[model samples]
Target: MAIIFEEKQNIFHLQANDTSYVMQIIRDGYLSHLYWGRKINQYNHSNKLQFVDRAFSGNPYPSIDRTFSLDTLPQEYPGYGNTDYRNPAYQLQLDNGTTVTDLRYKSHVIYKGKPALEGLPAVYAEDKNEAETLEITLEDQIADISVLLTYTVYEQRNVITRTAKIINTGSASVDLKRALSVNIDFRDADFDFLHLPGAWGRERHIERQPLRSGIQSVESRRGASSHQHNPFVALLRKGTNEDNGEVFGLNLVYSGNFLAQAEVDQFNNTRVSLGINPFDFNWKLNPGESFQCPEAVMVYSHEGLGGMSRTFHDLYRTRLCRGTFRDKERPILINNWEATYFDFNADKIEQIAKAGKELGIELFVLDDGWFGKRDDDTSSLGDWFVDKGKLPSGLEDLVNRVRNMDMEFGLWFEPEMISVNSDLYRKHPDWCLHVPNRTRSESRNQLVLDFSRKDVCDEMIKMVSDILASCPITYVKWDMNRHMTEIGSAILPPDQQRETAHRYMLGLYRVMDEITAAFPHVLFESCSGGGGRFDPGILYYMPQTWTSDNTDAISRLKIQYGTSLVYPISSMGSHVSDIPNHQVHRYTSLDIRGDAAMSGNLGYELDLSKLTEKEKEVVKKQVSTYKEIRKLIQFGDFYRLISPFENNEAAWAFINKDKDEAIVFYFRLLSEANSPFESFKVKGLDPLKSYKVENTNDIYGGDELEFVGLSVPTELNGDFQSHVWRLKALK
Candidate 1:
């Protein structure tokens, strides 16, 4: 059984494959967290909450017991303004203007399968026996409000997902000041806080620090899970590394404004909370209406950060991402964004596609400026029709030109944006999100569409659908270039003005769900500038995301490495672009670039026709090699050997699930004079099996390769150099 309820002790223990989460109903029916870590046969109730008489710790039941205070208990979903001064998991304001809520255990139900979150993206169980869910109801009698906390545990993965539903069971409406998804308390604050923080182009860089006395957090208030901070955080025990110790990771499956925080109290206990950012946010729950927060995924790993990452990779790659392309090997495509940008004609696009087909590329993507007289970024965003001047033969003619070359075709669309110069904008001036009489700020000469309005979403769906249905487009690069500004929905009421951001997210999801469902054969890749909206929410509709706009090989070493902490390799759209690279203007070797991009879904963003004959040969070889190993790279278990953040070198490997094949990639950013000899050690290999190294007569036991490690080539010299090794078991 994945979940066990000890009735007498009132303890609820949820067990994943190798981890466990235990909580119990304590004094006065308060739900408190007990333990979360390595799995055990049974929780002995040894980690019980301690009742103490502390000064200034307000107690609701002071007359019954002065020592029993909610302030000291390690609560599962803590309430605000009821003595616990730490940040709350949720908050509510009654019609009488009091911001106090006391939630006590009411009832609970355990089920075999996990239920889906209404209108939200979440990890799901395909089979009933694959997971179990426990829904516990906590209610405040005075406010007539009930908070239902849901926990789902995967039977074979070290993952547990949490969500909360706030229901107003009274006649009066209540304002939800804060409705965070999940919260947990730890007994001590001796852990290191780890998060991914970076700016645009250089996204998801790893940052770690020791937990201080105050609150430390990573959040995105830019109306997106912005490139500034990813919606994920982890607590690592002291001395933990990639392959050892313990870690607790929490990732929010949301793309809008969010917050992930860890607060260390004076007593040294740590409280971790994750959910929607309460900044400029509130939800009005009317009678019989309930609001569901986005799901928060929690992963516990005793085998270190690598184990935690692998658990996330496996779960997300299979369960979280859905579509025709989810399990399939991604195509080797060439995107013409960098090759042609906004300066391409139909003939120029075909020339690049022709060069790509000759070099073994399987797909050709025609990027921005193909539609609606859009010669540059300043105009024609929402008008999805083809520009007659650029594509005189129409979009179908261009798609057919590429399809006739035995290669698939794809197109790029900034569906969530509108230019002031667009015909669509001229037709419906109120389509863009803005307050009346306010200056609508524009980024890249585009304004965000008011997706909170269903009419606007329906029009977008129709426009995009018409194009997809009119051609043989097999892939789409759905791009959103800017963040929200002047975020007000004209259709919403004054009381719900703050609901614009979240409502827009919901509308975007609805559009994606409808469009993707209509065209199941199409492979959709999400982008926000690049990697700006790269969160689990978008991954649910689109299998992969353009990892970043910065394709510099040396730069990607850190970007991709940090991204792998939570996202799977299959979910990252990595491509090799020309150098002096477009984003950073740093020159790196083509071989090095190919090596970096090959670690994920391999593609190219450079003009294939511009490469010399020798470079063409190298590109051909890279394509062939990726095809040979793409299955393993996409579906294998990944391990991080060295980090680019901490070392001058970065090393990672992928081993198939059957343990018969493995691939290792080692990179050196800059060469050293007279450097010490090094061997790249790898994990997840079968020790007893003998394997043959590809391209060599070398045969060795897996034990020898894993323990003794592989020797790094001494002749490798220069900045931004890399090496790859392939191993196949000698059956």
Candidate 2:
């Protein structure tokens, strides 16, 4: 294992055998650096840094670019003036005795005991166990100025893990509020940035209906502040109080300007905040405290998300994958949420499994309503016992029956939730999260379990783990229905109410960590109402996430786009839902729906038994084609050729390594009648190479294909038309 570091540039590279990863302290770079363009040094300010130009300047441009100043100082506490008193001026101790002063503008500063290099530290150990831990420390001198940047490398599969810390070494206590933001740059031509209405609420955009524009920002003074401005951008704030304790929580701020009311006793002098956004998870750190976050692991590929997710899975394959599998390829698994709603049982599930097998499905997941007398949302949550009435014989028998049909079996469980009518809730009413004497709220007839309590977490863990131990279940769909409200914990005293959320999340992580450690072969999919808890933190434990409940292809175009900005497609749980849609009542072509869903894990949530013969044949061919190119699709380089948000038509492409092969899926969402040629030009290809075109109307060489981008036919003749083109470069 070799780790390379470039001290002058503050850049670090890690290489383990054949795999390589890069990390840079991007103090002055913008979020746009990830995709829009390359960075080029045009003017050299000093030997330490340079003024660079951004290659791409479309969407996601950085807010600012400035020189980074370096300084050396003697150890001191709150040195000098009032505001600048905390800023430390240190000597770099260069070989030459000439001391350099005021290297950069000093912002808020603190004392760092020793000097650490900016680049990756070389690892002398040959094994994972022997690998030395690398630490890089820098004091942020600029007060109130947040260091924001995006980290990416040319090659895919280059796992980049980064963690930041604000060490409070000053004598006078300082209040620190910070955020970590990640902007994903895989903008395909078909990407559409969706804008939602209502503050902390959900809304969709319609083409023909009234475009409800110009809505004022409304602030909700509920338990926490929430505002919903645009669908893509969401801000949630977690804060601390005066005495240095945890306050606020994972508050979902949609689009509001209201400040959170501070509870007098709830204030803490030292704390950290957890911010959950659509793109990245941000955290706030205080003095003497350290927050460890999951690193952003990247996998480079010539393939797409399907390929990338498989690559990610391969990282922990030893502990996850199991059973007699067909080929190393992932099974074309189909879930039943969008297919048959909450109306499924043992016989119904077996029928779906049989039909799925006919469609070449490798796994059959019986989602929801499988246990605890959970026929409806109104009853039996928190109760983990298998409902013998639902399964009849037992869960093991159902799993074995599914396995007997030459398919893997998976089940869904909401271990963190309990219904008021549930046996568990009836037995321990105090276990659910709620304020005494207050009306307990319910979403989907469920309330969150008080995982902050050790007993609650332990019992839930045992219930879930025991089931996995008793059955040969290959997959577990872990779902959390709603965000927390009425934030109170029975285990904590009044002063520790603010600690409830953090403790709850920590407890959840603990249980998951133990479960994964014990049943290393079982794959778990983390889902929160569908993409709410989708963050790198959760991804560290679960390989994939349920992308969203909105299965409408048009809606998914935006949801998946925003999601892909920070997360890889491999971790996205996309499925072919009903055409008329289950969540959002939007009608999308089945072919387009399948193509869009295939971009992710490539599964179906709709009932295969209900499909028409033609639809079934199309699905069969789709499954066949997916198997042939699934690797490329799953592990390829993702480029956002065109954003569906910007254009009426949606277009995106995936290119394999060597740039030898590529596939572009274009959708003419809303047709324009009497348009000239009804086609659009594509981008991001080698203009010099000649290429063969597959599955397209026009055959062109690489030169022509590069110079004269393919012409995708318009859907003016019909709604929801699509074009699938395969290109092979001739070197």
Candidate 3:
């Protein structure tokens, strides 16, 4: 059984494939964390961690028994008023202006299937037996609040998902200060802190440091998951790398401001927490109301960091992302963003569409200039109407023309943004989020819509859905170009002003849920400038996102590499752009650009008609090659053969489900005259089988590929050089 409750010992044993997690109810109804890591069946509940009394610390229930203390125990859900100083998972502020909460385990129930979070996005079990869940309810009797800690174990994916739901049943309203999704306690600080942090251009770079005394945390306060800190953190043993050592990964399925923290206690024990950032957050839970926190996934890998990453990959790709395109091949698309920018008309778009059709492109996306008078970034954002000046016949006519050219059509919409000069803004200025009389900051000449209001969100859904229904558009690029500023909503009270950003996200999810349900066949891709909103929360609605605006091949090697640490390659929207590459202006060969872009959802973001005949031929070959290997790239098990963060050469490989075929992609940034040749070895293959290289019919045993290594040509000493090798195993 994936979930086993040892009733005799009052212990809960949760197993997810190769991992096991155990917790038990101790003296005075205090729930304590026992063991997590590896698959073990035995857990001596009586032999718990020693609880020592300490000064200025929370004493365990029944003050007479001075031996047990909450401050020294490894509690699963410690509260603030309990006197436990090591960061409480939640805090309650009563209506009388008192901040105190003491919660104890009330009851728990084991179930066969997972339960859905009321108003949140979570990983669901497609089948009844694929996962099991345990719901432990804790109550603060004095505060009249109940917290449900949910744990879901996937039987075959080595994944454990957790969520928290807080119910307010008191007479007066209560304010929830902190309600973290997951809080875990480790026995000792024998690990390192691993996080992904960077700025606007360079995002999600890998960083590892020693576990210090104070708290180490990663957070985003920009009303987004932000380009700064991704909502993921891992604890790794010293010297742990991709191939070896124990690692524990925790990821929050949320896209707003989030916090992931770790603190080493006085006794060297580590307590890590992840969920909504409580800095500028306060949710008002009135009587008979409940607040559901976002889901956080936990994965343990004894094999190494690679195993940890692969576990996240499998669960997110197959279980979290939904819709028709979840398991299907994404169409090869060409966007006119870099080609014309804001200077293109319907005729220019039609010209590009015709050219792309000739080059065998599957889709043509009209990026930003077709709607309103959006010739520049300054005006007409909320007006979703198509400008007849750009396309005299309107949007449906262009969609029909693109369909006539034997290609699917896609349109872009920034529904969450409003322009001061637009018709919608002129009519309903208060609809945008802002503080009264406070100067609202704008990025790219736009303000964020107050999605906290249902009327505004509903209007957006109607406008976009009507356009999609009337046109033959099969894809929608939903975008939010700026972050929220002066985030006070006009409709919310001053006391609830801090809840605007989170409410906006909830409204956005509701809008997406309705529209995607209405147009089930359409593929939706989310974007924020580019990769700003690329997080698991948004991935629930859209299967893919634009990875970045920096299409430079050299820069992409790192951006895409870092994104793949938690996100799957399929979710990244990458494309080959024209050189003197737009963002960095670094020139590279056409094949090199395609090789880098093909690592993601294959696409082109340049004008096909203006390309030289040779470049067009190169594109034709690139599209064909992607179609040939996309099955393996999209659904295969990926292994990082070389780390871009650690090595100069970026290399990775993928193998099919049955392991009969494999392909390796390698890139060389620059070559030196005297550097020695380096050979790369492959992993996760049948060693006894004989494999044949596709380009050359030479055969070798799989053992040679793993042990003796695959020969890479070291003589191609040039800038931006790359290679792609394919192998098939003979049965």
Candidate 4:
């Protein structure tokens, strides 16, 4: 690993191997160094900022010098750079507000902060395999003011990445309320903010406010008071009703024992501020105590919120790129929960395997109700033994039977939870995360396992690994059915209670890291009650995630459209369930449902044995079509030609990487009141290039498609209908 510091360009590049993984880093126009492969704390208090001038001019500041001064600085100057700035050992202040001292200073101008701070540039490298990390530190003290910033940069692949841990090591915490604003060119008429619930499943919105100055704060708390305290705030600036582009700003304020706050200003000026808030805020940090806040990420792009989302996603992908599909075969899987529920034996699984083989399914997954005394959701959890009543021959025999049918066996495990009625909870009630003697709540008849405890995490990893090693299971569907309650950890020390959530997540990553290392070929899918845990963080370990429980074709159009804005289609699990649609209770045409499901990793969630003959035939043909074009749909670049939100009719197109073929799906939600023809002009194609169109029923080409876009004759008087066209570029 090498750290490349282009001093003249104000850019720091860290390269691990030979990849340009971490792209670029801008340090407010100051000399920045590239540190390589070093622990974070080594550079703590090393980087210092000199008070160069007052009356700063730039969006943040004209120069780093203008922002810090020694003489008469705020008495409570909160530390910057690192989150744990309240420690007196790291604090410094100017006597006469003139000069201070550097606690972790290495040189004159170079400052070191966390590796993540350099943004993308500091960690830029050529190849991820050989990439190294660089630790850079800087510090300056004149009079009473002292400032420090440290960063680390490294390369994992052909990508550059950087992470910064900013620490304001000063006697008086300074109000570092700063904003780094970037001007973005959005060429779209409307946009939306995508919100993913942490534990709550309710949908909230920040409507498009078409005016230049207003602040809206929405509070969301699903019965957790501490969670309800701080409301997420959004500020929108719209140019004009007719104007397409609008400037939006979001601010997340951190209060309580920690005094850090960040505000993003993008209306007249673009800037982001990270530091302590100055308004009526005074918190005492005991001698060795510390405070840390969540990271603040900003995105600016010309393609609206969807484009901005892609930027962040692309950044994550570049940093964490583990190839998917260990082998090159479509996973033909059957999840047994819907098939047999809690009633199944070795012979029962054998029967299902025989049926699946006849239907071309390649994997048999045993969902919940397999472990402990678990006949239902209420009983055993944490007890990872086979339920003798259900599977008398044990999991090994069941797995062998499925494998003998030339199919892979898979199993489901909610490792992060435990049923209160289980033996594990009965023996070690303190192991669960709850305030001592407080009421313990249960979701899905289970309590969350305290992953923050090393012993609990170890136990889970050991039991899960043992099961996989003992059986021929090739896949694992890891599910988390509920969000956290009680929010307290028994393992963490009293002072570190706030750190439990982060520690639990870290523990999860550790277990996964070990699992994937041992079983490289086994596939893992992360599910949080469905789509609750669908985020870039979870995607780091799993290739795909269950999209949502709502599989109604009509509702899914919007649900999936919103989902695709952030995730790739390959990562979405779209299953064809029985109509009178299970969740939404809306009946959709079988053809429409199959077509909608085809837009994702096509599969069935309904019981195949219960389907009518006609329905089964529809599924058989649907499966055939999916097998034929799954590759094109899976790996193709997607484009939203017409938004389902803007128009009643939803239209989307998928183009293969070669650009030789494309598929456009247009669904007419309802007929327009008086329009002669309910057709919309489709975009995202080369107008001059002639192409042949193939609908399942008919094929049309060249001149026949020249004037009018693909038309659908009124059916049921044009209430709700759909049309799909496969377009191939004519050679």
Worst 10 residues of 4 by lDDT: 178-187
Worst 10 residues of 2 by lDDT: 262-271
Predicted candidate 1 versus true structure: per-residue lDDT over 1-731, tens digit per residue: 99999999999999999999999998778999999999998998676567788878988877887887777889999988878999999998899999999999999999999998888999898998999999999999999999999999998899999999999999999898999999999999999999999989989999999999989998888889999999999999999999899999999999999999999998899999999999989888899999999999999999999999999999999999997888999999999989888898889999999999999999999999899989888999999999999999899999999999999999999999999998999999898999988999989899999999999999999999999999999999999989989989889899899989999999999999999999999999999989998899999999999999999999999999999999999999999999889888998988999999999999999999999999999999999999999999998999888889998999999999989999999999988888999887777889999989899999978888878888889878988889998999998
For residue 132, give model 2's deviation from the true position in Å: 10
Model 2, 1-731: lDDT tens digits are: 23445557544454432244334445442111112111222212222323344232211223553221111111111112211212221111112322222112122221212121122111011233423234444343433222212222212232322233334333333332222212221211121112232311132221111112111122222221122222122111122111121111111211111221111111111111112121111223333444322122333322332333334343323222222221144456878766665677778888888888898878888887777887778888887878888788888888888899989988788888899988888899999888878988887788889887989989988999898999898888898876667878877766456556555666776787778668777767877667655554555567677777777787777666545544555667778877678676778778889888877778888888988989888888888888877766665655555557677777777777567788888777776667677454444456666667775445566556545667765443677767788888765
**What would the TM-scores of all predictions be?**
0.99, 0.66, 0.98, 0.71
Q: Model 4: residues >4 Å from true position, as ranges?
A: 1-162, 166-300, 303-330, 346-353, 670-676, 686-688, 695-709, 713-720
Q: Which candidate gets the maximum TM-score versus the true structure?
A: 1
- Candidates 1 and 4 compared by lDDT, better number: 1
All candidates' lDDT scores?
0.93, 0.52, 0.87, 0.52
Model 2, residue 676: C-alpha shift (Å): 1.6
RMSD for all candidates, in order, please: 1.0, 12.6, 1.4, 9.2
Q: How accurate is candidate 2 locally (lDDT)?
A: 0.52
After superposition, candidate 2 runs with Cα above 4 Å error? 1-329, 683-688, 695-699, 714-716
- Candidate 4: tens digits of C-alpha lDDT, residues 1-731: 34554545434444433322121223432332223221232232243222334442222333434554322121111233332121112232232332123333333232222233211111122353343444444344432232333322333222222222334444544322221111112222233322322222211112343322222223222211111122222222333111123223222211111111222223221111222222222223332222333232233333344333344344443433244462233475667666677877777667766666666666777888888988888978889888888888789888888888898888888888888999999988877778777889888888888876889888888988998888668888888876677767887667557555545655676676677667767778777666666654455566676777667787767767766654667677777777676576777777888788888877666566666778768777777777777776766667665667677877776777666677877776766777676555444455566667765445444344434556755553554567777888777
What lDDT tens digits, residue by residue, belong to model 3 across residues 673-718? 7888788888877789888888797887878888888877866678
